[model samples]
Target: MVKNAYVHIPFCKSKCKYCSFVSYPQLELTKQYLEALQEEIKYFYKNEPLKTLYIGGGTPSVLEVSELADIIENFRFDKAAEITVELNPETLTKDYFKGLKSIGVNRISLGCQTFDDEILKSIGRRHNSEQVKNSVELAFSAGFENINLDFIYGLPSQTIEGFAEDLKTAAYLDVKHISLYGLKIEDGCFFYKNPPEKLPDSDTQADMYLKAIEILTGKGFEHYEVSNFAKPGFESRHNLNYWDNNSYYGFGIAAHGYVDGVRYSNYQDFDTYFKFPHVHFLTHRVTLKEQLEEEIFLGFRECKGINVQKINEKFSIDFEKKYSQILAKYTASNHIQKTPQGYKLSDEGILVSNVILADFL
Candidate 1:
């Protein structure tokens, strides 16, 4: 029943200042890590022709093309499946892109956080702006028409004008998708210990977001999700599987997966992961009430909000009566609107989406 899969590669040449994900800079662990990852997949993968497969990482691109191929060969994919790999621009080579295409990788997500070299250094990224440009050109030449560029706003020394320029540059690259995120200093990150100076305030960050929505939508990208924009059919299918609450397999250290109403995450420590990669460090059986709450919170993240009729039918509850107060307050305040499909977040609502979405929970 699982149709989507995610493989985490924790290896990186160097870690970023704000990255809190479980990633290691040790290259010596590459061989053993891949072997353990394959074993984990072998244990859980159902051998179905998958709908989507995403290889995300500290740096999946750092591995040799042959090593990447060996891992992919174990999985069976649909003929037209969306296979995506997260690539660090500096690690990409023409031959690597070619090898990926040969192995049926149809999508490429390049981490081009910003086009400013000074900001790049400030954040500890290894690649320069030129490397990002070359990486996109190489991906296109390798026959990957579905490409996504990830950019961040509200970084140290970032300005509204600078972020707008970055978006303009991204649009010029002919990419099919863009993921724009605001920087947050989470615990365990270098930024948490040493906070960056001149970071954007909440108001400035909101302005930056609104500006991006104007620019990207003007360039024909659909604002499908809170942080993602895409061309009509280029929305990330793998991610949509998550928003839709579908079951999938997640493999590797610190990777999380939801299956049969239970959510589980693998161990975070490398030694413990090698000992038992399939054993979950945390597991929670979601209750029906929690599922209903999640369906609303996650669904609202997309432009297409929760379907009232569907919720009523599926949960056998009066959708309107249950949330009558919430509906009345938000709609009256112009934060939500009724549509032919269902109730959706207003444009203004999307600006404060996190705050409003919490009310649903």
Candidate 2:
């Protein structure tokens, strides 16, 4: 069953320097874009009540609550479905928060990349540190208990101490969840064209990540996923669905979806998407070999790790025979800890997870 869905709103108030997502600052295109999105949803949605729904952005909060409601009304959610929306601090208001609850949005993922005023401007984020604090307070006032704050480490001019301070501040706020990311200069982002000076080196970034794990775990948050920390029962169900390789529907321009072992993406261009929003521009049928690789890579991302027995039985292959050499190397290095269930990345392993995960592929 396709019990998870992702709705992409490809409009932002302004583009952030590090963002390469398909988003535009033109408000005039919103109406037409939304109409096309509705058409796509109607044509593609399988009508199963969703167990989790995530409305991600450009900036979903840039739209008025009424407009957001129009989008939400199209879906049939399970009785206890988790519905989340990505919010920008400067875009929220008390009324908007209340309206969000009315439309069944129970989770708010605020993009508060960092708590430094100068860094905020440097990254092209419209909100300042004060706005971020105020936004969280306002969300709480509006009865939002399941709130998530996003933080980025290794940013230009960011030090290990500075990133640690950000983690402490997020913990003090008492949010239910947090997501920490390392800055990458992806092609087409501003940093890719004109790289930022004083960005932390890989070793420094590793230290920053370790510090975050220490701080957040001390604050009673569980490191549920590689980049996500959450209080008990507050883990992101929609995201877990992805890690579990469950099928889902993705609607809107540049959105990607995986359903029944085939991955597909919508056209990125506005004109192309608007012309035939129901048609996917890219589609790839995942092979059994690729599926095994994904199952390992994605499952290993969780703190609990992958179930070796389950993987072996599901894929009809002996896990040990297939990857004994890979296992021996990492296990000998203490990068992977063998658990009763399976293998999970050790603290040392997580610091250089990309290198290890790439080797698995």
Candidate 3:
């Protein structure tokens, strides 16, 4: 059964330069959007008592507390379920957080990006460094214990020292989790049309990633996933659902979900979504070969790597014999290390992970 659900809120105050996610600045349409969203959820949701529910979007914080609570009331959750909301630092207040807690929000993922004020402005982020600090304080004061700060490395004009300082500042805040990402100027973003100056090179970005691992690990955070670190018992259970290749339900325009071996995505345009709120724009039934490939690709993303016995039993194949050549190649180069359970990427291996994982595909 699908035990996780994700709801997308598409309203944002403004678009960020480096963000290509499907979010709109038309706050005027929020009421209509929420109405349509409720309709979609009513038609599709089976009320399975979700284990995790993530409310993400262009800016979910832009909605009123009553509106957000209305959305949450539609679902049934397990007693220990994790409910996370993504918020921007600028839009948060102590009362806002308290209201969120009252409605059962247990985790907050703030889009901190960086503590460098100039860099934040360059990236078209609305919140400043001071706001982020204040927001964290407010969240804590509001009784939130599970908080995550997101940071981006390799930003334009961001030096290694500057990035290190950003991570250190986040760690010092005593948040429970941190997520690090390398900047990517993808199409549909302002940076794609007008590239920023002094962007760090690929090699430099790799260095920043390694440095983050060293610093965060030293600060008592576990590198549980490729891009996420957390204090013990504070890992993101919602995201862990995704990395585990489990099935989930996705509601709202531009959201994607995988369920019962079929992956589906909703329409990206508001008009299309409103007209056919219950219809999926695209759906693909994953084949056995593709599932095996995904099992390997997604499993390797975790620090524990793939469980050989589990894979063998799940796929009814001899794990090592099937990919002996690829295994031997990387193991010889020390890129992949042999673990008691299976194999995992070494520090060097993670740097060229794309190249290695592609070979498996």
Residue-pair clashes per candidate: 0, 0, 0
C-alpha lDDT (0 to 100) for residue 283 of candidate 3: 99
C-alpha lDDT of all candidate models, in order: 0.90, 0.91, 0.94
Local distance difference test, candidate 1: 0.90
| Model 2 alpha-carbon miss at residue 256, Å | 0.6
Candidate 1 residue-wise lDDT, 1-361, digit = tens? 8888898999888889989988989889998888899889888887988999999988899888788888788899887889999999987888899999998789989999999999999999999999999999999998989999999999999999999999999999989999998888899888999999989997898899999999999999999988999999999999999988788888898999987789999998799999997688899999989989888887888788878898888789998899989889999999998988678898789987778878878
Off by over 4 Å in 3: none
Off by over 4 Å in 1: none
Worst 10 residues of 1 by lDDT: 352-361
- In terms of lDDT, the best-performing candidate is 3
- Location of the lowest summed lDDT over 10 successive residues in candidate 3: 298-307
lDDT of 2 by residue, 54-111 (tens): 9998999888888889988899989999999999998678988999988889999999
**Which scores higher on lDDT, 1 or 2?**
2
